[model samples]
Target chain A: VSLNLAFEEAPLRGSISFISQSGTLGNYLMLLARAKGYSFRAFVSSGNQAVLEATDFLEYFGQDEGTKAIILYLEGLQDASRFAKVVRNIVPQKPILIYKAGRFDVGVRAALSHTASIAGNDRIFDSFCQQVGLIRCYDPLHTFDMAVALTTQPLPKGKRVAIISGGGGYCVTMAEAACAWGLEVPTLDYATAQKIKEILHPFAPFPLNPVDAASDVRPMTYARVIDILMGLDYIDGVFMMIPFMFEFQLRSAAAIRELVDATEIICGLPAKYGKPILGNMIPRVSVGPALDLFQKAGIPFFATQDESARAMSGLVRYAQIISLAKEVPFSAEKPRFPRADQPIAYVSRVDPVNIPERD
Target chain B: VSLNLAFEEAPLRGSISFISQSGTLGNYLMLLARAKGYSFRAFVSSGNQAVLEATDFLEYFGQDEGTKAIILYLEGLQDASRFAKVVRNIVPQKPILIYKAGRFDVGVRAALSHTASIAGNDRIFDSFCQQVGLIRCYDPLHTFDMAVALTTQPLPKGKRVAIISGGGGYCVTMAEAACAWGLEVPTLDYATAQKIKEILHPFAPFPLNPVDAASDVRPMTYARVIDILMGLDYIDGVFMMIPFMFEFQLRSAAAIRELVDATEIICGLPAKYGKPILGNMIPRVSVGPALDLFQKAGIPFFATQDESARAMSGLVRYAQIISLAKEVPFSAEKPRFPRADQPIAYVSRVDPVNIPERD
Candidate 1:
């Protein structure tokens, strides 16, 4: 239906999948997701859903190994009870993010005209999503922001996140948000602080909870800090800032080699320590070739402190969601809408190459 | 002291000014700001605050014709009371946005090492900002997110905002945010809505608070919808989404003219109506030449729904701040510190070509 949409993008396979009511809105989400270095496993535009609705597709992808995270650009659920039933079973093993439109009376009216979907009482819908263990996103971009961490990184075991920074400003910014998001920013132990001080420049700030290197930053400072933080028993993840643009002037062969070496260590830590590492810049920049190195190494850089911290919290909260799900018995059910004899569109087999394996 | 910083930037004169304790951090902010189509009026790296401190620069730019919005990347106050006195006078006339660091004990310890300034209580700083009518930013990029609207757009009279969208999903996303931020998303009256409906694509959704044009959107549709929304009796501002990419495939000169004409109407709204018009995308992107036309016309587009709402709320809140200031008696204070004998670095007169005068 949206073949006439502006972009005709070649599929770049990854672990995220989206099911949207409006095909145009789905295309907008896809464009931005690709900009953030995420690629969809499949996208289903559930037009009118006269036969196969959103949840039917949701149930199919719920067990699909390729779809680690599912995003819904939703107006209204086709079968509310059926959705709640299916999601309760799937969320135990997978993540489902919903960007529910028509939350207010004004938007509800808009949704009615755009599609013939009934946007029920919003507060009821919200609590229902919570009850079913589905993550509700406030905006379209927000769906991508929270979904990225779940798809790419290893889940943090607990709420203890170590924040490391090249600039002290980011430490304050990320710490404020991390605290607000119910994640702990614990102080570094004396032994770990001493170890970091030995590697830092003489004029640099002393290591603390944020692990502020300040003026001591280099291309490799990030790798060293991550190594020490990830080694700590109490830390569950590292949500940190990198100043790759600080080393952006070094176009020489040796400088380029130094950056690649540092990226290898930084990217390797999440799998090494069984924790997530969310990288960011203080002022939230997306330009520079230096960023490409980390992205290529599979370390997706979040643009803002709020985003990176919120992404980290998404991982921590999902840990609880998954843990809670283990107690509930899974109800296996047959699809209500009979499948078409034709195969589903564009959904392929699982590609393990995209997902990072935890040791 | 830090002339070795990577890129040498040519001065792109504009209304925003920044004063930071850390030079590196300020540069990162500038890089991202430029990427968002902003240029600096003056940047002062307050190194160690030996003779001229951050407040000294603040007091200077507070009076400078060029600096419409003042951004402070602060660690700690060298002289808190005098700083308070100076800012209270300046903030009523021009916004002084502060992104304060050293909030918690962890960040405080880092700040002590990074700069030789005494860190204070976090709650006190936040409350003090609220009491004195100064806006306290949570993050560094947040400073620009709030500051851009102040420098570029007119102050909204009230909290009422009309959201217009090419995509129904954005109507939901933006309306959700605007309401959360305390801005009213009031439905359009029968007459006004009918007028909007008359111009909309016949199959499109009815215009309400969000004014969902949906599939009815066209290059000229934005100009017509914005024209009605801006001219409304109740609307204080319009925060809308544009999909120039919908018409992106039309490579002919005719399609380009259509987009360019819409840009002129959208950008000219604030000055025309004495209210602000903030443009955005559904998934929050920053690409396309269609944007270049809007940027050249002095309209700044915020990237996220949260950011656009927050920016709108910043303007509404500042209007209250200005009103509060007007009620209080003005006590003029003299600068406690002496001025530099030589001229201040790069502080020049503002070019009025940048700001859109509110009639």
Candidate 2:
């Protein structure tokens, strides 16, 4: 929904609410959400904060029934203490994911000049976020990625991730990426390996943590293997990598249909088994339909294994934050700092500025 | 130009030659180049490297009259010493930008399975690249970004950069990004500051390294400020951030035309003054024509300030590498690593392997 008007075929409904200080960023995010099939409970572009500040919106969303997670793009703040109080109050009930720009001195100066608001000390803000259990994101795309994973998939219980792939190479790449992203890829148990071996052709590699199904496995066998991996008590999550180009050349229609079916089945297992499942498809034009299917199924699909692993790591981190928040109770007290009411000045462009060109 | 046949209105011509190990990556790159209006001298997909490898193509492009930079996507190598010799030989004459995947164990295994070639010790390869003065990139898009900057713009003499923006916020963000990427945004001298202030309105912030022109400054004034910045002997390059949204809202048709004309002028100054000029336009649907204009003028336009800075950094790094390569002479004798020829094995998909599904 835009500031001027709201266009809708139906009422928007989801667990995430996005608030942006920049209208352009808000618009871009809205377009991205529409393209990626992500829904939101509400979207607000707090242009200049003329009437109300981000703190007020946070207070409202604290009691909001629809929003389970909050995503914010804040350039600067008018009242740091009030903002901190609001974050402390709301973070217990919902996850607050923030992308605070102007981390450096130049960025801070730019923020002040752009909005006439002071961006407080970045180090203090970082500490405040850590204390308040806020998830800080560096980029907009990553913010969306983490938000989607948090809202859709169940929070991962641990960092152990099982890598599954139709090709050995993808499995290897994902295993490395998973480890680099702080997720462990432990070797499967001997019994589990024996069971997997019984189901695969002798030419196929032995079933390990990154269980490679040797490129031409039947879809049913693929689904069974994934189910077995997910059911294992030791495995916390699954990272499935699909080699689209190889599969496309083999059986484009049948392979895609089977993969779609398998993904639907796998997605259902996430909720029933309490383990998050993430999919990474080798980016190709032919995989568009398959990607659409995964999106329709409410599965988080990434273009690269590194991105997928990073998202999974975020899920794990958020889960840990929520659990830690449960252990530590935040104090309920108003900040003592005086709140200043600054007049909002809109940038006028009617009288065009003419600067004499120097020789 | 594709593998099947050329479907061209005219012969493609540019100073960059791209070689990919995967056809999918090559095709995707071709699409990106077409969309971004980047012409290429040559594009080769060394599929399986059955007879000829990436080194052979690099050797050929090294002597080609049309090529000035080489971009490679290498999965693995059959003869490491031979590849190193080729890179050392070519890099002195042309910049060789390589994106070598399979840095980790999983990635190495994947590389081997994908193309039946053993990925050698990554650390040794890294040292070899450093010794040969090769520019290494992490991703394909980055490789392309670096190649465009290296071939299209003159090498930067130093790391000092001057950022100019119609919007204060973008300049600030770019300044921070520039510093983070190791490019120094030194404060403008008193003379330079006075000159910029004369070209800007009194209400605008005082001219600094990140000179912010008030949003409504005429496009001609914007061009003049950029030209002045480029002409400064202290500045090595210029990062110009255009506030397209602000201009679009003011007078879209005339503003875009003027902006387009200003960009054309700014692009010409880089060649005339021997300083690199990069641009970042606030990405919006309405700014398509403006972006297209930049692309048509052969100016590298990026989506974000960080990306623009990173590309500039890559260019600077390449320049440094070329200069250093001239100081060190590569040995004439080849190393004693044995050359092995392995038959390419195509992934067969005819016999659908049936594995018993375990309940």
Candidate 3:
């Protein structure tokens, strides 16, 4: 078979490069990336992996200056030791985010049908990622979110967050979600409370950490609430839920765009002060309006507030990890192909003897 | 086939009645409702309209007196005139809110395949609903929102709305949405603005209509914002977007509920002075913890701010029709089977003429 080596000069200089054994998963991820507006260095469908291996590409991407992160959508490992070594080498220079599919019986079945290959146990891969400093993204959205967070906000010193909103429930949800994500929500001091009281309502109460404003208020309340929350001593970040003004109209497309742009600008302001602003402004009302705003602004806004908050949690956790430890890069190793004499069993584990006896 | 009529018994009073063509959609709605601590009056699947039709069940609920409101998951009409007639008949005596499914082509296909029936054009259904008194809900969430709105709040007199929020974008969106929905957002006078400024920020320009509190200085900010906006002239309703508070801290759930309840009490205070609370209080946060508080206090809280606003819009539109029209009841017509003995020939519009026309 003849093939074109497309890259002649400065090969692997640009784009996100992903190697996956399952083409269906690769296609799904590609579609998701396109929908979420994620830029890729390259996405290669590594079918069979009989010749070119995953480690070969990892090593190549490890030194490639253009590649900021390498994401893997793995069904199973061809060689576990080589995989760990390659990821270790890449970590010091760039982040290695791993998403291992085929972890369950159903996933294994799907992978078998898609790639005609058997999946191995996931515990080994999970341990390998943890040891090699790979940032594992549980979902596709989270993968993009981590990429955006690393590319945007500076890693936080700690996980202490304060939520400010026009509604109390939203603030509480944010606080609860933050705590669930290992962040803290401390009470404000009397002095801080008094300062906030000057600008807020007397009945509104001071130290309203997650300020929940009423419905009859104007949009300016969010800006003020955010300012007050950011002023707090313990707050490392802010998660606010903003409304899509145009969605309420549901009429003019122009109105929705304007709302999205203005929303993006206002929400993006917190980042100007170097404070992480995790906003829940899902364009679930209409997908077309604020999608470009999210993509262009490099924010992880989704179609649901829950999704936005969850993505924020992922980024927050990954940010904390990067702050705690330095990851290693893959060692310089030569590629190894499977010997022709050895049988390459596709249904490697489903055989009778290999089946685990479970209670 | 003998079927149990236990769902029709008087003992099942005060429970939710669910009717849907798609079992999955029905199941999802049921799950959401159950999660919200609501019990069902009856959960019936109106399969293909070949047996028990939507009109039949709606009419039964209308006169039953046990059903607070009749909810429907409609895909298409088996008989348009019969459905319209039945809806108009039951609407005034009972609120029939519908979660119409086939809004888009994909939705139509899904509806069709799910029920093994053709979902008629959505445009026709939209026009038919407008002609009659049917309340159209955007999604499953909004179906519940509209139901709560009708059950809790009194019928609004006019389209004038008062929007309260903590964010600029949220307020603007609310204002634009209100305007688009043909609701009036009356500007606040200088006096009201001045009083509000005493409690709000200097830069928090009370854009007259959307009462922007501008900051989360305290929980009192919540009451003050509502008070100022409600006092404005010509404002008949209010739509508020509260922050997600409880999601952040479970300990703060009571505090958050107190904050909302206090706001509602303040809103009710206007009624003591003869200016009745005309609008709705839609807290944008989810009702996971504060559901009991909201239900008992009489403030309609919605999970999403968008859904809340949309429900208010629906209520406003509904009130307009109610004022101009009479109450409608469900149809008494029954589905008639086709002729017992007839040649079933496949007919085509392209060949309208028979052999008598040409050959």
Best by lDDT: 1
Model 2 residue runs over 4 Å out of place are A1-15, A24-41, A47-51, A166-176, A190-221, A243-260, A282-292, A331-359, B1-15, B21-50, B112-121, B243-260, B282-289, B329-359
The order of the candidates by DockQ, greatest first, is 1, 2, 3
Clashing pairs in 1: none
**Candidate 2 to truth, TM:** 0.80
Across residues B171-237, which tens digit of lDDT does each residue of candidate 3 receive?
5434543443345566667787677767766666544556655534355675666766665557666
TM-score of each: 0.84, 0.80, 0.42
Candidate 2, DockQ score (0 to 1): 0.14
Query: Candidate 3: which stretches are off by over 4 Å?
Result: A1-19, A36-41, A64-66, A109-113, A116-118, A201-207, A216-219, A231-233, A244-273, A284-297, A327-359, B1-359
Q: DockQ: which is higher, 1 or 2?
A: 1
Models ranked on TM-score: 1, 2, 3
Q: TM-score (chain A) of candidate 3?
A: 0.69
Best by DockQ: 1
Error of 2 at A148 (Å): 2.2
lDDT of predicted model 3: 0.51
Prediction 1: B-chain TM-score: 0.84
lDDT by residue for model 2 over A1-359, one digit each (tens)?
Answer: 31212232222467778887765446555654544446777777675799887788778777888777888878887887788878877776777888776666666766666666677777666656665667765555556667777777888778888887775545655676675555777778999989988876677777766777776446556667878998998889998865433335346677667766765676578877888988865343334454555666677776655467767877876777767666655554522211212111011110011111112
State which docking tier applies to candidate 2.
incorrect
